[model samples]
Target: MTGPDSHRLVRSPGVGSVVIGPAADGSRRPDLVVAADDAIDWTVFDGLTVPAGYPWPRIIVYEGDDTGFFDWARRRPIGTFEWRPSSAHVVDATGANINRLWIGLRTAPLHLTVPSMPHGVLTVNGDLSLLTAVLADGGACPAVDFQPDTLPAADAVPLRLPDLPAFAGAQHVTVTVRPLRQAFDCASLLQFPDTRHLSLGGQLVNVAALAQLRHLRGLQLRFCPDLTGLPALDSWPELTHLIAFNVEEATGKRLRGELRRPGREWERSGVSQLRRPEWFATEYGLPFSGWPAAKAKKATTAYRTAQRAIATATGPDGVEAAIRAFVAVVNAMPGIETTEREDAGDAVAQLAEDTPFGDLTEDAQDWFDDARDF
Candidate 1:
């Protein structure tokens, strides 16, 4: 394609092909068409000029370094752009709406200034302090996904946005931390009452404070194994989706009961309830009783042997055999405690000569429940 200078724009044969010129309407419309490449010489589009009154492209998807692209684009009158930078030094999002900013740098910190953009979504995979600084500088972005490069310091110094009030209109926010660390508290987000969706992962312990946000509609808590408390569901009448994974056992049970409470208006609101099983059998090992045939053979044998000894044998030798058999059955079970084994032994010894084997079996089964504290 021909440029304003009458020079032919170089069109590479491969993916990095360039197309720049006037449209079929014969207007002096400038189009810097460059493909993504490992060795993209951005200077190829230099010196190109657009005719006045020509409609500029509103959305520019950039996938390479920000060498001179921002400066070049800022000079033009564009509306918005989606920047997916693999490696960039600094982004000057001063006057455009960066709809989606994906920082793919795995190690280095991303530095950017967001003086505008009332509606923007930022996804950073490096040091999150850059985002905090941007927000501190009056950047009015509405959505952010912050995944820090390393864990926060152990002093409980959470990552905070002192100027979060600047973006009080934010609707969505997501924070993920690796190795499951509590890098922040819920209080930091109290100002964003307009937030409709929120997701938090890692060691967030207590989320009961979030009940204050009555506008929240969707909440997801993941990998927060230390989390033990939740806000009342009635507070967030607009909430329709609640999901939690790997939370504390007590908290899971409480949430399950609360979300499924009969006759509650919130429960009738069709809020989806999901919970991980809180039973010891699912968490640690197989259930002492009701185990599948392949897994319960040894326990079954011990139980049957104990019943036979209690029913057919007589005197102290029979009582001893029955106690030993019961102890074997208890030992075969998982998470069995010493006190439970002793209790089962005592119960078996109490079996009298005329005692029904059925009664003795019931007593032994009761000890299994005590072993797991169920």
Candidate 2:
């Protein structure tokens, strides 16, 4: 065992460093220990091999980050990857070829291009923009896990994940990217020749989609919000282990019926937290004109101001202060009508709900009513 900072890195085409140690056969054997404390490129293992009559290299990662190291090792010439970190892993020189290809990595100080594999069961943990790329492109996988943004890109058209050949023969494929609000064409998934288990997460999908993939036995939907497509659940005889997360109640019931389930099999967190305050602000009411226009401006301004305050608010008191200010502004709006009051209160309440304010206080509505005049 060595201090965290003292571990030397091994990035070589051959056994970088070998330690002659005990053998299970009661003889001394040179054990190859490739350890690194700094970030190494994915290509570091491109030409790495183990000589005959010697065991595969044992990698000890004390402080190095691996990006796309898992999938690259799962392509062919199959080797088992434990996927655990900060420990010794005997990596087969030829790497792994299995049905399920798990793609995830520890943090990287410097990320390298992920090599493309011909095909198989795919799982996504980070940036999967690679799903949108051509399979033969050599390099696929998003360079960065694009920040999960809360602000609604109101006018921006959401990106659609296109169908690619990488998924055609894959038996089990999992791709979930929810915070980014990307969509995928469900109909094209039918083209997948032999898909059995499918998991789609953190993206927009038509609730009534994914019905045609007949051999599908397991389906896990996570953080998929949109329900916009032709509604039909293909009844696959082998169907089992179908579940979902963050789905609306109505949508869940619909999904249950489609999947032919008895009880509620899906659940939701009912939270859509955004990072930007502008994401919550929306123009209240229909085209404002005359007195209504001025009043609306004041109210909306106060709401936006309150949102910004809440977004930057450091503590419970800060959030309370922001809410207090909002209630005060709503109370002062000149001759504020019931409709205006309701709309402004709704907006402010929604903003607060998006934050942890509800969890911070008991009976938030009572507090809002006590502070609000209208």
Candidate 3:
């Protein structure tokens, strides 16, 4: 092969710089051998030829790295070739409708990117170290980017890549923004009609615009502390999981209220007092101060828990520590256990006696009376 830069040896048609020649030691080069189309005939074969029409079969070879292999196969469009020492095969795919894939099962470093693969199972025989796949927008292929890191050894699982259309068609959609941030607008992405799982981890994003996702299910805002507050999630009734770690009180409130129901079931680990305190109030509302004594008891539980954590800590301010120790001592000095709340229903009923009360209204008060007894 001769080019503008230099001259190289070659013997194949349309295949440049790929040829068999003599070595410096006068030995023949078997590394560049080309075999017949159906020549599964060779004993120690490293490469093979595919006569036009048929799909490439699996190839098991003994080559170390598959970098050059993929380059040659993609360029030559040959049939499957199996090097020595490897049980896996190689394939040369063509056309947009191609599906079948033959992934080698060695620890060799292979680098190739396929935008789309047709509907089929692409099996990998071994661990795919540092493997990456990126699909285009609206790319058509029922392919699942299966990352089965936990598959048992000697177990070959044929992972079918998930369909992009199927994911896009759901009531929730997730997107990675590292690559498409420049080409696509973040605001436009948030406006996806049915998108829900917006995981903007380590990606440049606009937190406020996310409110446009009316059907959002889960929002993962990991390591995005610069995001001041969360958007109002009342618009997104379907939102369930708020996977934010360090969100401020304002943002946390919105997330808690949207993802959790008010009152007892809503309380969770690290729940801020600002968000749902009313849920523990006497009026069955949050921000519990205005509520009855029952709500005060619930708030007292939280205060007691905080006190225990502080008490268990090693170092404390001298004055505050003394006060806490004194309080603990006073608590240990408990004397009596019984105290009953003045039942308001009885008092209200006694007052109702002064007015003209019907029997039905009295019976309704009896229902309240029964609730208090329970």
Candidate 4:
């Protein structure tokens, strides 16, 4: 008898043939990724046999019309359904990839829906029409990320949020990146019904409107220049992780919630896990903008300079020195506080994220803590 640690094939990412390999994490048979690189018909898998008790494939459609792909994938439990382009993937559950899936980034304008699919991330980047179609198809993911690729010209109408899905399921919702100009009220948010984590960007106009979301466990505010002050943290019973940096002394670090970097441009929350603080600011709200002309210019110059250094590092090993330099800059700043310290640390994490240096996760948080004193 074989030991339980023996490897098994989990998924196959082949076309015209079935290519198998050992499961890196240890399964029963050889493992493979099921998503094909090219847009192929579902019939391609007809010849790929599975053991009687093994599960069917969970395919990822990277390009082309998914009408046919949906017809086939929806047949099974739809274990993990994703219509992401090579770019449109969202794996932002902080670090959990077991019951949930990590969806990718999609730059193209396409709408796809697989009804009654299991929990995953839904990210729409081109138009609200895409969002509309997916909801219409009865598709639902626990997390919904809505970002329109571009804004209409000043003379044109801005994109608007589509009506909420008829059923309730979303647990984490992010309406950010590229502002929505159609004038959104919080009522559009109330429709989610089950959202425990909510993130909003430049379009935020009022904070009081969130009073009704008593179930919220976390909230993230990004670039809300028009934001009214936040409500008292204690008012809500379930809210935990909120804003990271405090601009107003009224809240200080006394906020009842901890801070977390909201999901990023390509890496939703995190594909693996959010181990420690990756505290990069999404730029300032009102306080930094109101600084004296020279002071504001200096801050921008400092940040941009640090960014250039980080990106131009000789290699992965050099990123540490570059990040350490950034910490020096933050520590040397005038009136250094939690906000400034977080900004410096976050800038490194956010910028290094996609680079080879980012994989050096164990060293990052410690670098910030070791070099800087708040």
| Best lDDT among the predictions, by candidate number | 1
Candidate with better TM-score, 1 vs 4: 1
Candidate 1, residue 64: CA error in Å?
8.0
Which parts of model 3 are misplaced by more than 4 Å?
1-185, 203-205, 257-260, 263-374
TM values, all candidates = 0.46, 0.40, 0.28, 0.42
* TM-score, predicted candidate 3 vs. hidden true structure: 0.28
Per-candidate clashes come to 0, 9, 23, 26
Q: Per-residue lDDT tens digits of candidate 4, residues 49-160?
A: 4465334454332332233444454343333434444433222122222232223334444333324334565555545543333343433454777664443222244334
Summed over model 4, clashes come to: 26
Q: Report the CA-based lDDT of candidate 2 relative to the real structure.
A: 0.46
Report lDDT per candidate.
0.51, 0.46, 0.36, 0.47
Residues 115-187, candidate 1: write the lDDT tens digits. Answer: 4545666666655444433542555555867665544232465555344444577778787763223355666
Off by over 4 Å in 2: 1-94, 97-155, 206-209, 228-230, 234-238, 257-374
CA displacement after TM-score superposition, residue 225 of candidate 2 (Å)? 2.5
Candidate number with the higher lDDT (2 or 4): 4
Best by the TM-score measure: 1
Tens-digit lDDT track of model 3 for 1-374? 11232333233543322322222221223333332111222212234333553433233232332234444444333333333213223333323232444454445433334424444433333344433333334454332222222221112332222323333323333332211112112454532456645655322335566777777766665323234434665555666565654333466656656556552222123333332222212222112222356544544453344345444544433223422332333233222111111222322232223222222226435433443321
Error of 3 at 349 (Å): 76
Model 2, total clashes: 9
Clash pairs, candidate 1, are none
